[model samples]
Target: MSEKFEIRREVVVPGTPEQIWAAISAETAGWMFPSPLEIPADGSRPDSPIIADWEPPRELAIHMQGPDGWFNNLEYVVEARDESTAVVRYVHAGVFAEDWDNQYDGASKHTDFYLHSLGQYVQYFAGRPVTYVSAEGPEASSAPEAMGALRGALGIASGATAGDTVTVDVPGIGTVEAIIDYIDDWFVGLRTENALLRFYGRNAFGGNVDAAHHLFAADADGDAATAAWQAWLSGVFA
Candidate 1:
């Protein structure tokens, strides 16, 4: 027998519903940091997609029908929270044939950070170029020890909260000061002077832990940004 499943991720982002919608609608690419946001839209889905529904500033749902008639879906929705903020939601749900557990584990972790970057795009780097670099870890997508090492490197405590100031002496990037954007159960995001950085700790399908990093720089200096993150991760997982 086959099983149906659903996973939902939501976050309150620092923008009006209209502003957030613009960024979300801008593109449907990797949703990671190093991916550029200025690619021209061709009115074509990144991959072959069967459209389900589209409501501006509200919802975008697509059907991912496989050869065997199974369903895999991706959806995004936003609700206005107030004049200056809104709630953004992403859901990747449906049926799968094999390795559903491990695949969804990666999806769950990836989706969380993806939304974090989207919220960041709307908040700080709208209309700017971003250099995004992502790495799958020694467990690359979810490791508590890695997160701990990162929190230490950034001078943030385990109980850090939003609004806390953080300063990390990044090896290739020099000293960077940022404010804690938010802290969640397995995720943390930072608003640096010139970039948005996020980390994720998640479980794989088999229940083993893994981790990942996504660093987005709006400074257009992709080489420097990538080098800094690559060096940083090498140290963290060394």
Candidate 2:
């Protein structure tokens, strides 16, 4: 019989089903795995490198590049126990060389990370207290000041870059760095599936204001380099 592995985990996120669906469905190829192989987004290969069989809020099937030029398959089935809790089952199936027994452990570890990351993303987007910094003053001055403070306070640690992780301290939202997109003038754009939140300065002027504005759909949860600036401005100014 071919070797196989299965990993199961349940996560409770304080978001609507739509939000969870969007997060899970978003391209996670290079973001979710520790060393995810680069595959064409269109899955044009004769043997599709990455394929997703998606049924929103219910099931998702992923086929990724695997060892021996083979493909590893993962099926995620989501069952909503309530408005806030979701039971997720991940099943992995693939042919592996006998010497690669340890691959099972690696796969399991990757699954754990995936579930944890998804939970955090969902919770944060659901308006969980990820960070909250209070700025006392007029919106103009306080906003910019708060933005600068957040940027400085989140000092540059080693290896902090786009797609990496870092946290910012807000007065209400605790310190959390699911992923660092980039630091803008007023706010940083934190990558999310549904939107990119622009974290700006609290006291800054028209372009410099401390706030989180929703941008647009993100290609990956860890992609901080590209943002829908035009769409974001339209939404914000509108």
Candidate 3:
């Protein structure tokens, strides 16, 4: 049996409507996953049937319907709060099959972290080019202690909170001072001079942990970063 669910969240981003739209629509790699989307420029709708609505700088909606009567919809409404700020209302509605409770739980929590990262991107690194590198830890990361181990390896205290300054040593890379931009039971976000780093303790959701680096440095090397993080993750889970 399939069950329907809806998740709603509101976030205040430190960017204008235009900037927020660009970040969500085009520069998603900076905050979210790098799934490049081709939004229609003309008044016409995009070729993909998934796009239910497209009003740039204001509203964008996506609807995907499966043949088995299951569907998923994601909508974002961006409203100007001031000349340099905006409020975003996000809605994610979908249907889940088996283990729907766990699915819903994970999805809802993920929205919190992702949206926070979006706000961080708009506030700190708006309009900057990014090199995104991601790596997943070994199967041992499924253990409950994986998050603590990863944080320990990064030199971040278990009780660290946002706004605290700390120096992180990236194995195979070098040490860099950073501020804790966000932290929660399942996610940790770090902001450095040239990068935004995210660590996902996904073992709570029955998955291996993962790490991503969104490097905004002028001479960022995505390939090198990927290799270094992969090695680090392996070491942490080994």
Please write out the lDDT profile of model 1 over residues 179-226, one tens digit for every residue: 888676556677875666666555323332232333345355656666
The window of 10 residues in a row where model 1 has the poorest summed lDDT is 203-212
Residues 45-160, candidate 2, lDDT per residue (tens digit)? 22334647656767767787755566677777777768767666667777665535555555555455445556655665543313221112233334434554445455535445
lDDT per residue (tens digit) for residues 33-131 in model 3: 895467555534457778888888899888889878899999999999988889999999989998888888999999999999999999899989999
- Quote model 3's TM-score: 0.94
lDDT of model 2 at position 152: 49
Compute the lDDT for candidate 2: 0.48
- The local distance difference test score of model 1 is 0.64
Query: All candidates: CA RMSD in angstroms?
Result: 4.2, 14.9, 1.8
Q: Which ten-residue region of model 3 has the weakest summed lDDT?
A: 36-45
Model 1 residue 152 CA deviation (Å) reads 1.7
Stretches of candidate 3 exceeding 4 Å from the true structure:
40-46
How much lDDT does each candidate structure score? 0.64, 0.48, 0.88
- Quote each prediction's TM-score: 0.73, 0.42, 0.94
TM-score winner: 3
